[model samples]
Target chain A: MIAILNAYRYRMLIPVNRTTRVLAGLTAALLLALVWAAASGALGISLWEVLRGQEDPFSVQVWWQLRLPRLLLGVAVGAMLAGSGAAMQGLFRNPLADPTLLGLASGAGLFVALWIVFFQDSGAGSLYGQFAAGFLGALCVCLIVFGIAKRQGGGSAAVMTLLLAGLAINTLAGAGGGVLAFIASDEQLRQLSLWGMGTLTNALWRTTALALVLIAAALWLLMRSARELDLLQLGEATAHAAGLDASRLKHRVVVATSLGVGLCVALTGVIGFLGLLVPHCLRLWLGPSHRLLLPASMLGGALLLVVADTLARTIAAPAEIPVGLLTSLLGGPYFLYLLMRRNRAC
Target chain B: MLTLHQAGLTNTPAIAPLDGTIRPGELLAIVGPNGAGKSTLLSMLSGFRSAEQGELHLDGKPLRAWPITELANRRALVAQQELPGFDWQTNELLSLGSNPSKSLVAALLDDLDITHLAKRSVLSLSGGERQRVMIARGACQLLSRCSPTAKEGGILLLDEPTSALDIGQQQRLMRQLRSWATQHHMAIVCVLHDLNLASTYADRVWLLHQGQRIDHGLPNQVLNPATIAKIYAAELQRIEGGTHGKPLLALAP
Candidate 1:
């Protein structure tokens, strides 16, 4: 028995060691990206000099007021989106499931657009108002998709029903946003279009703080469900037989993903594909165990966004491309490639 | 032990009320024609579906009343043709949802004849191989939680467990199941299509026709050729006297 246990312990160490190594690597890369993003903007401000107070006062101000909050917001939004994506995929038991694909982001964007059109001048455009609108939109869409899935009787059929529901919600939300855009004034149009394009330029200290706290809470909830998510991959009935409260798990994941993805869309304006791309790639690297996948996806996402946002700002200096455009540009082709490969395999 | 008192489902693939007691150290086979509600009956037995007419009791308490986790500790179900949603190593799949000892996991893999497939991804396994892996997982779920001093190992419910297996694999699996029932004092209920395998391995057999259990008794008494042929609506020849006088059934060519 002792010998058998020792062998098992040694066998278990392989995955644990790989998890530690991968997480450590991701953390180091995230720190490097943070420093790099902080340093390379419109104004070249070295992080070391900013810390030492040797940079000019104006450079320090730019670093603190403009760059720091944006970078922090980028980290929070990216982590939340990717973590929520990983959790969502696990909950639905489909690798293709994503917050954006499931219409959560578009729903949130529509509500934020509504807030911008009607409530902007009414002093309801505060962070709280935007978050509430976005959260409600996401929650509503999530419940609808979940309801449709439940009605379909939940098997492979439910997965297809979920995706179809997402498609319908996405179309409806897009049309609503277009209507909102059509009626807006020129100034409001510019704000709406820029927000729709998804930039971190509007990142403020207060919004950044709010995004961090809420994203952290959502991510914590998702991570707490890691084991249950793993069990769910066995299919719902089998998972329930294994002692999981399947309905409760579904509710928790639905709420967490809504909160996380909604807050991200509200703050960052529908940053496309970070949720889909980060978790999908990390699953290939670390396998599908959520105990490791969730945190790895979170760190990987933060790193990707920090690096991508830095490029978005610096690549065309003096004017910035929306980071959303950059991620979509990269993620869209990869998504097609994944679909092609899956088709070929089939 | 699992006791069913007029338990049945009213769903589309309905089952008439069934009253039966499945005891530890016994392997009970539920054999029926396709669309005969065999799997539905298994689901009711596993407590995945509530009995519309009556109740199921696991140990002494109502099966539905037992907390899910505690019930999981007492029972495990292996469904038909389940494909895992993600790629998991064979051993990882075996130990999922339960913390079985290394020796127990190894033993299950060996018993299932898939020890060599332990490190391979479950997605890479053939259909028969994956079926065995799922059965081991079900066994692990029960045996790991079973207390040493407990009177019986928990119930294991299987739905068409041998549907994907070849002849050799089917024989090995059935033998292993019988061994587990005898050694671990586990009550096992299997929905099988092959009546001969049931007759050979199962201590008792329940023959179903059109959602109702028409007959259940010792294999020899219940699986007699005349009733099986009538219920199955197929020509069958019963070869008399083999291996302790158990009936050997074959289709009429």
Candidate 2:
């Protein structure tokens, strides 16, 4: 009976090998991060109190309303950003592809800044507007990058063009944001800067709910194409020869990535390094198969962001550093380390 | 059966109007000098590139009419040397070629004499070993395309299957391919640069030059001294007898 089951398992495209172990480890880490984030805020609430169903007003307000929403939003935003990052990396067949690197964050940032500076007075402050405009901006940048890359043909040439276009778009968006910053009032400037730094301070229940839905949908799309993504890493011609519809896969991954990153930025501002850091480091640990990598990155990203946000809130108690700033601080050094290690290996 | 009825790609640099029919249980070896449309012909035959002016049919159905998934199952192409983007076990890599059963994949690995390397990352394999693995992968694709009971024969398309192999390895691979062609009753078209190997192994040879078919016949008839001299622009001393009763041709000093 056991042998028969093993035979069945072995035939599965994404087999059960090492997946359970990885999932278990990530789940443990996630639970730990969740408990830590929920309990260690400015208004301290123990996990025990929350577990025992505390009904005190302060505990309810702090734990359920504030801390819980923030933690869950961080989880959704991180998962979306990192899951999209993994898909982008697979689509481009490059290790350096991240939402921030591809101008999704910058484009969304520019739109959000535009709204904050120009449209805030005209009732554009709603959560729906923020998600709609920001996601649209991200989707536009992603599709434009994809369009330019497609024109360049396949393989490393397309990936190179996509990266260059990303850099150009990011620079243009940054300049636009700079101009917006220059003309804004002090209050507007502060708000814009805080948003730029990346924070989950705006993790209200309504926005979190929308982010969860969008993130879940995007992740589903990415997961559905996991096998195709794996084939794509063999190079576009190779993938096509292997019977994958390469163009269709690219379209799906691009659309999913944009929706994911767009909503992520809208919810938590432009959180930078989680996308790049999570997938790159995980690829080294787990190898490069997207079936495992995509789902694993989602869980891992959620865990990392929750921990990072916990640190952001607690390290300087009563004074919160934007979670984005904390992530950049952690992610920047790691990126450099990876670069040096890769250089040495090469 | 695969037939190319005036199937041609005139705009393509290396291939002109190609016409041929490759039937099951036959082995056709394509030989040409560099930039002589060998790979291009194989590409069209494998349905990677569509014929510009004419039609290509497999089992009397136009190549384009076949769904990609079904076509992929029936035809597998092993292109020039490819380096995977990540480290994959040899077996895992082969599985990506087609959805073959695990037992079948293991058998293929054993048949290709790469069973020992199955657990190793493909990145770590030598070029010759990688080539063998690639051929095995293609074979697995053909195997997966057929049911155990029905056994629908398929075609194996290979671009320079032995380019990196040592002489002994090359002979072993050729013998293995021959056995596969006969046993599975699958059509095999291989692009080869070495004339001697083609002469020794190919049941029929197709010689091409300047985007045109120079000759197509049994190896001895097509790879004659006069045709070699004219197409290759080199003089060669043609020896009388070789292994398998084929003539041996060596470059004249």
Candidate 3:
């Protein structure tokens, strides 16, 4: 059966060749975006000159100190958010599931707001402090959602319960962030609002390196569960009979998403919609197989963020728009289109 | 082989304790009225739900004691109304976990009369077509993983295998199941709603009512018109002289 299917897939050019083509295309696009992003900043450093060892020292410094770290951070954060989104959708077995929609990003954002409001001046505004706050917030929300779903028992009902719980948590976190914002001093408020809108403005080698390690580890774990996730699409009971340890898969997804997405929110604020948009687009083009979707989403997401961040900073040169705002602006309409298409398909 | 030693559930809509052994090369039909714990019994038998009151043994060991992968290899369950979450091809769906060879898959699909659906998306198939596809997948799961020297083909448990099939398709499925049981030396159990199908196809019949097993024996003896009518609380007429003297049941106008 597998041989016949493999032959059919080859004839249709759907699985193997398509996966290779999509990944290769996305990787090439990402490299282009990286070069464009690295060279298109305010100082206008010429990457070609730098490569040829003929660029001015100041331009090299600007590229090394500022653009390089920010670009790397953009790639890492984008991949983390998109990869988590794909994994969450697979875990929940819902095409529309995403980290932002499920409140992981907001939960992290809330704690970051709290940190800004209450501890910024007390030596707790360090990078590690921000990550700890964000991760704790995400973990709390993850536990609450999983706990409620477990109580509901398993099946489609549990998935619905988890989604509704996510909605409630998103609302609650938004309100909490509001309360913190209202009480924050003017200087603290500026920091809080800027961070809430999401940015890579704080990109530094130390923080970027930390985010890289954590996000890489999390993505690896998510990728490893691709086969189990495929079986889960048959529903939990059937998957269990097929030898899947579903509860263990659930735990892995929750921990990986919380850690990966929490760190993204901490380092780059709440970059909404990239997670939802990237994976959804890829799924449409490549079919819903996670073996390809996860890696493809990672590359597609990195390409998008690099381009968006470039446009964000260079569009208004010397006066930046938060990349998060740009992504939401782009993502909002695309998500609406997806909903309409789904309704039509039904 | 599965042995149920006073095994049952204690939850609402519970099943009363059942003591029985399902042996290879036999087709057992579990016939029951609404809310009669047919599905609940099947769940316990599949080890998806533990027997709250007693024990279920597979090959003389506790059902729960077998490693999950080994248990999966030995028994396959096709639950009712399964809708695939994605648009997987029928063949891909069959090969999800078991890794069946091409010949085995083709043979299973042919037996279930779904060979034409091999490359079609499961989501695009009709209800009856999808039902057959899932059954093929279940059989593939067992056949692909069965050890070469094992005495019996693994057990195949099906929940309402013919609920969506047409009468002709239903007859074909029942015959195919019987063939699998006998030819492969498999133990097959089906939860059936149609008494006539049970009587016509099953080697043995278990009649359940309101969480209790009222009677179980050869189909001809257990499907007596008077006992079925009273237990079902309905007007049922029995037609004698069925194939091999099996009793056929029909609803009275």
Candidate 4:
């Protein structure tokens, strides 16, 4: 229902005046919903009680240790992946582009495989080992993608190169991960498999706080480059005439999007389509102006992911499903719907 | 005030190779072949493309030197097929013309002679109406100057203004332009395909071929039959020559 309303709001065949009003309304709704969902996770918790002047140890522990951290991480992850995808779409002018250009997913996956291989049986250094492996692996993949993208067009090649590079590395990492899992002892294999599927289960206050800082900084940078993103849709030459410096904007978008993607990739093994689903839907509803499109995408993407995260915990009576699996299952259909609709339009 | 002297802006694949200058309060017409660099030249002068060589000045300062807002405040350009229609709420599309007085979108729509169609979808307007809407939007940018004299600062860059309009609509627009250009003293730099229309209204014409300025002067000098034949690679018969004796070409054979 909201998507249809957005479609009407963004109808270029109609006047922009009416569309603007409609988009404004839609933006307000999405924003309110976003705030409501984030707040709901800690509705009666200790952090909420503290801020509201009610001291309760049990609620505080639950809020700070669980709900508060999850809320922060969930919103950051959703917004970062969604905004990164939208920026990439505008930068390369291809709607299919996603956050994986950094190769963080693959890099992280490889590191996780190594961690399991070397330290799976050991009890100590587990958390630090996972973080180090994931962070290093993702960073290495980003540098490699950047290296290959440089050969193709430096800052401005068709997005196909990025997608292709991501696909190859993603496949290699997936293969390597599979092989490692195949040979692991039964107990280690189960643990590796469960973790690999992705979860926000070990949510920590410090980790969530750090994610917020990185995500917010990245979002701010993306907003600054948005005007140039508007110009990009018309092709590089047209954008340049619109007084945008194309190469400069491209560099900024790629780097900032990488940061957003890298952070999320490190935190969650590999979640797809938050970026794809959000922007594409918003474009259909709000038209293509980046000012409205970017924020709207963020709001919708964050809300969708948060809801998925909630379902992940509640569905199996505390036997959790990896939020990544649910996101893929739900998002895969939404993506197919977008593809079918756009193809018909073409 | 805008000035371009021996300006040559190069983009990949030979899209820009034209030379010319546009000044305050004067309407200059750019007429040429499809790949003749009209878009490129316009982009360069409007601060979108950097001229690989040549001097372009806005208010006597180099175009590149002007601040983004200062440049936007002074110059407004509508590139060809940048917006197509005929549907956007006539008023909604018009609002994009000027940012400050955007609240008066309805008034602008009425002034453009489509008030009745204000409620209609933008896709429903005729091609001529769509062209008028583009001009109206460009005018919005000019309105932002707000100088008492109107001519103190204003430049409009339009590409293919009449190609979308019917003959009657063309005259209505051109007639309005005479007053609008004079009242605003707008430095109107437009790329047009119609020679007769160019001769009828434009104060000056810049003729380009293969990214080169083959001719630049009064409409009569630029729109001659021999020149038209050579540039277009077509035969144009001279009959009913235009104002100042400029030959009108109706493709012969």
Best by lDDT: 1
User: For candidate 1, lDDT tens digit of each residue in B1-253?
Assistant: 8888898888778888889999999999999889888888887887777788888988878989999889888888888888888899998888778999999999999999999999999999999999999999999999998887898999998888999999999999999999999999999999999888899999999989899999999999998889988887889898999778887988999
Per-residue error (Å), model 3, residue A191: 1.9
- Specify the poorest-scoring 10-residue window by lDDT in model 3 chain B: B238-247
Error of 3 at B226 (Å): 2.7
Q: Record all residue pairs in model 3 with backbone atoms less than 3 Å apart, i.e. clashing.
A: A1-B102
lDDT of 3 by residue, A304-344 (tens): 89999999999999889999999999998997897798779
TM-score (C-alpha) between model 4 and the true structure: 0.76
The segments of candidate 2 whose C-alpha lies over 4 angstroms from its true place after superposition are A1-17, A50-55, A118-126, A147-165, A185-187
Residue A35, candidate 4: alpha-carbon lDDT:
51
| Model 3 bad stretches (over 4 Å) | A1-18, A120-125, A147-164
TM-score per candidate: 0.94, 0.91, 0.92, 0.76
What are the per-model C-alpha RMSD values against the true structure?
4.2, 4.0, 4.6, 7.8
What's the lDDT for residue A138 in model 1?
Answer: 93
Candidate 2 lDDT for residue A288:
83
Give lDDT tens digits, candidate 2, residues B1-253. Answer: 8998888887756476667889877789999888899888888887777788789999889999988777877788888887677777787888885678889988888888899998888888999999898888888878886666645468889999999999998988988888888888888999998899889988899999988987898999999988898789989999987886799889999
Scored by lDDT, model 2 comes in at 0.83
DockQ of 4: 0.12
State candidate 3's TM-score: 0.92
Top DockQ prediction, candidate number: 1
- Sort candidate 1 into its docking category: medium
What is the lDDT of every predicted structure here? 0.89, 0.83, 0.87, 0.69
Residue by residue across A172-287, what tens digits does model 4's lDDT show?
88889888888888887876766577677656875667667867998889989776676555444433433456667866876676666656665666777778778877776666
Question: Between candidates 2 and 4, which one is better according to lDDT?
Answer: 2
